[model samples]
Target: MLRTLYRALWWLAAPAAVTRLLLRSRQERGYREHIAERFGCTAGRPLDDHAPLIWVHAVSVGETRAAQPLIEALLQARPDARVLLTHMTPGGRATGEQIFGERVLRSYLPYDVPHAVRRFLRAWRPTLGLVMETEVWPTLIEECQRRGVPLVLTNARMSARSFRRASRFGAATREVFGGFSRVLAQSPADAERLLALGARNVTVLGNLKFDMNTPAEQVAQGHAWRAAFGARPVWVAASTREGEEEQVLQAFAALNVARALLILVPRHPQRFAEVAALVARHRLRCERRSSWAVDGAVAGTAEKLDEDVQVWLGDSMGELGAYYAAADIAFIGGSLLPFGGQNLIEACAVGVPVLIGPHVFNFTQATADAVAAGAVLQVQDAAELARTLQTLFSDKPQRTAMGAAAAAFAARHRGATARTVEVLLTLLP
Candidate 1:
């Protein structure tokens, strides 16, 4: 009865959802481009006759990137396997294009309505489905189950807040979660949460993000950026969310440190212009990476930013490594207001010390482990962030030691992708 009602509610909300998508398209035009795919109405490119399809649904950029190592492992293990990648966001689709090119099939996932999911499954007929992280759609799972297409939840996690919300539905939550053939969790604590939610087959497979190898060129670019900064103290506020940027700007304003340069990277591509406007509103001179010419110049060159440019807007996609490499300290955003925080593993992988806000329930275990490893520091608010940055700026030795610890912490967590791939192999047709 609950499941039926849920579907009914979703069906009733279809018009509103379409309107929402239309509204979002105004800011992000890519959302408007793939209209047919979202309803599972269009036929994608014809499938290969010799190879079987292995589907992976990564909701956005983060989960898509997290699934990278596992995706590569699947491809290497079975050269005959064709990948069907689906994403809810344009960023994920763009990242998929950049990484996998024309090798894999990419599409916008259908809305979690029954008919759309059925149409999607009917069209593609994926042999196995791997839903990255906690993107469980009840109708989609039900359809997959009914169709005998095995589905596995990979690198799964649940924050306390998310757990509470799921628990409210009682058996409905179980019905959805129990549909998964297996749940590979990031931590033991995550496994416990899944078990309590009535997931029968849950295993702690660590974090797939740890296995994501940083591109060497990206790291080198980071070194170049650091060199470009010369004697100035540099820090990065990476993957920052909506309200948090204001807090970050305010904190930087309070410090009034002339030599301290901030590389501010907003989480969403659509917000680049907005963030730039905010920087201007704060009366801070800033240069955008997107606006930078391809003929790269150094600190003393003609193309160099004026010393008055206080913040460097990291507006480009897929170059986070460069920002982290150029920083003395790193602040992982999305934590300041209550958005569950962005991934800190990338920062750690680049050997940068991290500072985050108190709300990191999404990365609960990783955050705790990092702090225990002496890799990350948690601050209460923006004022505290300013004060902490001030202290770290004055002490170079502490930053170096912390960076080393961060790298070590990231290194120790490797091998999850291998474990995850092994489980995936078992489900293949």
Candidate 2:
């Protein structure tokens, strides 16, 4: 009865959804491309519905990247488990498609309406489902449970605010989480938070982000980057969140930005253009990596050749590994401002010293550990951040020592992929 009514509501709202999409079509052509690409609703061979698939859904590029190590593990562990990867955002879907390619079926998760969920389940007939991080779709969870599709929430975390909201409707939320077969969370605090949210049979599984295996290309690129500006000294303002790029620019100004190139990769790719515009507005020359084609392969040879270029805007998607290879000192963004810090694991994985600013509630444990290990330096403001960057530029030995500590910290946290795979395999018949 619930599913029946939910589908009806979806149908009624369909017109509005269509209209909104049409109005934004020009502005968001990639999204339209995504829907066309995903649904086969635009006239290609339809997505196969007969296979018994393993469905995994992630929110965006960040979560999807975090889930990559696990996805690779699952594919290796179960050769027979045909994967179905779904994402809510167009960019997420794009990243998913690029990463998994034809090995995984791609789709936009239907709106959380009951009929959509029912249609999705009935069509895919997945053997098991994995929702990464906090992708809790109550209706979808309930439907999967009712249909006997085993569900697991992996690498889960819940902020205090999210916990409080779930607690207020504890009974309802509990009912939702009860549908999950198990929850493998990132930390004890996360496990406790999920338990509070009525999530069932949760266990502490350290964050998979830390377990990421760096590609050899990344290592090679890092060496190349070091050859280019490694001695010249550079500090990367990586994964900067909105409003934080300007702050990074301000930091560059306090010292001598001319001497150091600020490599700012926006946490969200959509802001790539916006950040480029901001850099231009500040009257600074910028080089976009996505557009650059260098002569003779050299460390940032394509970009740094433009000596007037102040900000190297990493507008490209799916290239963090390469960018991390191209840095000396790194600042993980979303921390400088109030947006909760971006993950520091990737930077750490590359053996680059890390620096962060206030606000890292999302990664409470990892940040705390990084700070204590002397693997990552935490600063309070843009002024301090500038001074810190300047100091690192002047001090090579300290930078090298910090980089080693960062790599060690990253090494200690591996194996979450294997552990997660173990838990996932248990769900199989």
Candidate 3:
């Protein structure tokens, strides 16, 4: 009965959702493409009948990237398997293309309405489905169960705020969560939360982000960038959310280091121009990454950039590893104004010292673990973040030690991909 009403609500809201997507396409044109897929109209080539279809749904860029190692492992294990990857956002779809290319079948997951999901399932007929992170769609789950598709919630995490919200739904939440055939959590705390929410067969499997192997080419690109930089102290503010950029720019304006370069990469591509403008407002000499590419390559020598450029706006995509590699220190964003922080594991994987803001409820266990391992330092606000950057910039020995610790911390948490793959394959027929 509850699900019926929920479906009704979604039916009513479907038009609004379509409108939102169309509006978002103004900033990101990828949304404009693949319109039919969102409504469950899959017009692509027919699926290969001989190969087993494995479906994985990742809503956005982060989840999509986190699913990388797992996807690769699954493909490696089942050579005859065809993975169907679904995402909600244009950025996620774009990132999928950038990472996987023609290797995996990609489509936008339909809005969680009965007809759309039914059409999607009918068209694809996946043998098993894996929903990444915390996405729980009641209608989709119910439909999957009705069709006998074994659905698992992989790399599951439930933050305290999320737990409280789900608790408020009482039995409805439990019924939805109980629909999953398995729930592989990132931590024991996450497993406990999932169990409390009535998810059965819950297991703690650590974080898949920790298992991400930095691209060797990107690492080489970072080395080239660093060489071109010629000893300028470099720090990157990676994946800064909306409000956090203002604070970060303000703090960068007050920094006292000589020839220091701040690389600001906004979390959303839509805000790239806005962030570049913000840097100009601060009166800092800025260079846009998109402007200076040479010979069809994104990164060229630093001589292309003005010596006085204080900020290098990271406006390009799929080069985060290179950015982290080029940096002496990295500040993970989305935390300064309470958006729950961006992933610091990427920077740590590159052996760069990391600093983050106080609000990290979204990544509670990972952040706590990183701090305990001395790979991360938390600052309360922009002021403290600036102060820490200044101190760390001057103290190379401490930064070196912290970088080593960060690398060790990342190395220690590997093999989640293997563990997760072993568990996932067991569920397959």
Candidate 4:
């Protein structure tokens, strides 16, 4: 009865959900493009009889990138298998196009209404379902189970706060989570949480984000960008969120370090203009990557700025590795403002020393491991962050040591992708 009520509530919210999508379309136009796919009107895609169709749902850019290694492994191991990738956000869809091209079928995952879910299942007929990190929808799980489609939640994690909220629903939460055939957790704590939430067959398979490699081309591009800047004391504040940018800018200004450059990459593309305006409000000259030359030179003489640009706004998409590569030190943002945190693993992968603020509950295990490994530094707030950067800037040896430790730390956490794929193989027919 509770399940039926929940479904009815979702049905009633359909109009509001569409309205939300239309509002979001103002910032990212892809939200308006695939209305039919969101309703499960996907058709005309050929299915291979010999090869099984495996569906993977990665809701946004972060999960989409995290699933890359797994997707590649599936295609490599099962030569006959066809992969269908679905996402809830336009950025994820655009990223899918950039990364996978026509190799996999791409679509917006239908809203979790029974009609839409049924239409989706009938259209795709996937042999198994792999959902990335904590995207459990009751109706989707129920429909998948009814259709006899085995579902696995990979890189799964439940925060203490999230667990408490789920506890409110009592048996319904348990029923939803319990329906999964398996849950591959990111850590032991996550496994415990999942078990308490009524999940069965849980395994601690580590984090898939750890297994994703920084592309070689992106690394080379980083070198080019560094060359463009030429010997400026460069640092990156990556995946920064709003309200945090003003903090970052203030922290950077406090340092007052001469000839220093900050590469600020906001978390969302829609916020690029807003961030640029923030930079102006702070009286800092900046360069937006979108306006910056793609093939031309850095527009200045060697080891000198043409106009003393203080910040390089990373407004373009799909080049995070380059940003990480081009920096001497990295500050993982979103942590400063109780926004959980952004992934710091990419910085570690590229051998850059990292700093993160106090609130990193979203990536608890990873942050703890990185801190223990001497791969990252934690600061109390923007003020301490500025002090730490200044201290590190004055101490080259400490920075070098931290960077080496970061690279080693990332290397030690690999093999999760292989383990995840091994479990996935068992679920496939």
Candidate 5:
């Protein structure tokens, strides 16, 4: 009865959900590919038949990125073990498929209704289930437990705000969380909170995100971008969200961004057109990143006073490493306008000078440590953000020094992947 009620609530959230979906449908066909996930794909045939599979759910791009090393580790350990990947968003699914390529089987997670959960489980019949981060589906966990499937939550975290809300439904959340055989959290803070929520066997395995190994190919590509941009002081607003872009654009306009590049990559690729409209509304001369070099941006020059603010609309997908590589300084977005901020660890791990806003609750543990390591600069608003960027632009020495500190912080925090894999191996049959 409780599961049924919770499922109803998910259905009720659909109107607001569908409304957003309709708004994002303006993208090209390639971007709209994940629409099949949310709608339905009727699990037709078993894609991997040789061995036992593990279903890992990563809802969006961030989670998908975090899950990469774990997925690779799994593949290494169990040559016969299959990965049946499912993502809530199309962008995530695309990224996973791109990263893993044909090495793993991928699909959309069925909706969380009992029927959908049953349908998903029956089709995959995975021997084990692992959810990255805070994806606690009551029905999914309960059903998996019923089937004797070992369940685990990897590199998990729950913010203080979320802990409070989940505490409200204390009984229910606790019962649902208890279904997990293991909960490997990013911090002791996260583990303690999960313990409060009735999750047993919780441990602090640290952040696997910190264990993010900068891909060599990505660095090589970044070097290529660095050559193309050629001494034009550059900064990237990587993973900017709806309201955050306007703030970044407005600040850039005020900061004489015409002289340098103010690149904006929306968190979701679906929002590319809507963001482009917002850019044009600001009257900035914008160009798609896909058409790089075609815009004929001359190197080693400054924007004239009368020139329009040349906003590089980063419409391309799955090349963030390229963006990070291209920028001398970086602002990790989602913090300024409040989505708890995107992970600065990505930019920091690459040793790029990093900046973020105050609302980095999502990465509270990691960001706090990064700040202590002098790996990040916190800007209160657009003004300070501009000043910070300006300072970094002029003070190349300081920026380079900060970048090294960030990389060291990243280096010191690796090994979580091995720890998590060890946990997974212990629980698996």
Candidate 6:
């Protein structure tokens, strides 16, 4: 009865959902391109019958990037298997294309209405399904189960805040979680929460982000960029959400380090222009990453900027590793307010000393573990963040030690991909 009502609500909201997508498309044109696919009107080349089709739903960029190692492992394990990647956001689809290229098929997953879900399932007929992170669709789960398709919630995490919210949904939440064939959690705390939510066959396989190996080319590019930066204390504010950037820019404006470069990378691509304008409003001289050129060619080896350029706006996509690699210190954003924290692990993986805000319930375990390892430091607000940055910039030895620890902390958390693949293959037909 609950599932029926949930389906009814989604059906009723379909018009609004379409309108929202159209509104978003004004900022990001890609959102408008795949409108039909979102409504389950996906018509593409027929699937290869001989090869097993594996469907993986990664809602956006973060999930899509985290699924990289697992997806690669799956293809390696089952050479003939065809991996079908589905996403709801254009950024995620673009990231999938940038990372996987021709390796995996990409499509926008339909909205969670019964008819759309049925059409999507019928079109793909995936032998197995893996939903990344915390996405739980009741109608889709029910449909997958009804079709006898084994669905797994891979790299699952449930923050306390999220748990409390899900708990409010009562049996409806449990029904969705319980529908998964298996729940591969990121940590013991996550596993415990999933169990409470009635998820069955749950296993703690760590985080796939830990298993992600930074692209070698990106690392080299970062090194080149750092060399170009030439002793300027470079710090990256990576994957910052809305409202957080204003605080960060204000902090950057107050920071005392002379000729220091602040690489501000907003989490969303649509906000690139807005962030640039924000930097301008601070009266800080800013040079955009996209505008950086080497001898008239754009996006090549970084050219040295004028000493007056206080902020380097990272407006490009798929080059986060390079940005982290180019930085002396990294601040993981999204934690300043109440949006939880962005991934600090990525910065740590690049061997950079990290700082985060007080709010990190989304990455509670990872933040705790990183802090325990001396790889990360927590600050209460923007003022403290600026103070910490000033102190860290002056203390080179402490920064070096923290960088080493960050690398070690990242190295210690590897192998989740292998474990995830092992479990996933067991469920494959």
| Model 2 lDDT tens row, 61-118 | 8888888888888888888778888787777888888878888777777777665677
Q: Give candidate 2's whole-model lDDT.
A: 0.79
Which lDDT tens digits does candidate 5 get at residues 1-429? 666787899788756665666665556344345444454444634665647777788988889998999889989987878788888777888889888998887887766666667767777778888999999878788888888889899889999989999998867888989999999999999999999999999999889887667677667666665665555777899899878988898778667533687778888776888999998898877877765443223332222212243677778877787678768888998999778988888898888989999898898988899999998999988888988887888787999899999999998998899999888887666
lDDT-superior candidate, 1 or 3: 3
The digit string of per-residue lDDT tens for model 1 on 180-204 reads: 9899998888888889898878999
Q: What do the candidate models score in CA lDDT, each in turn? A: 0.88, 0.79, 0.89, 0.90, 0.80, 0.90
Off by over 4 Å in 3: 44-48, 294-304
The alpha-carbon RMSD values of the candidates against the true structure, listed in the order shown, are: 1.8, 3.3, 1.7, 2.1, 3.7, 1.9
Clashing pairs in 4: none
Cα displacement (Å) at residue 98, model 4: 0.9
TM-score against truth, every candidate: 0.96, 0.90, 0.97, 0.96, 0.90, 0.97
| Model 4 agreement with the true structure over 234-326: per-residue lDDT tens digits | 999999998999999989998967789999999999899899999999998898877776542232322433448999999988999989988
Which 10 consecutive positions of candidate 1 have the poorest summed lDDT? 294-303
For candidate 5, the clash count comes to: 0
Model 4 local distance difference test score: 0.90
Q: Residue 83, candidate 1: how far off, in angstroms? A: 0.5
Off by over 4 Å in 6: 44-48, 294-301
Give lDDT tens digits, candidate 6, residues 261-336: 9999999999999999988888888998888863312233568777788888999888899899989999999999
**TM-score attained by model 3:** 0.97
Question: How many residue pairs clash in all the candidates, one count each?
Answer: 0, 0, 0, 0, 0, 0
RMSD of 1: 1.8
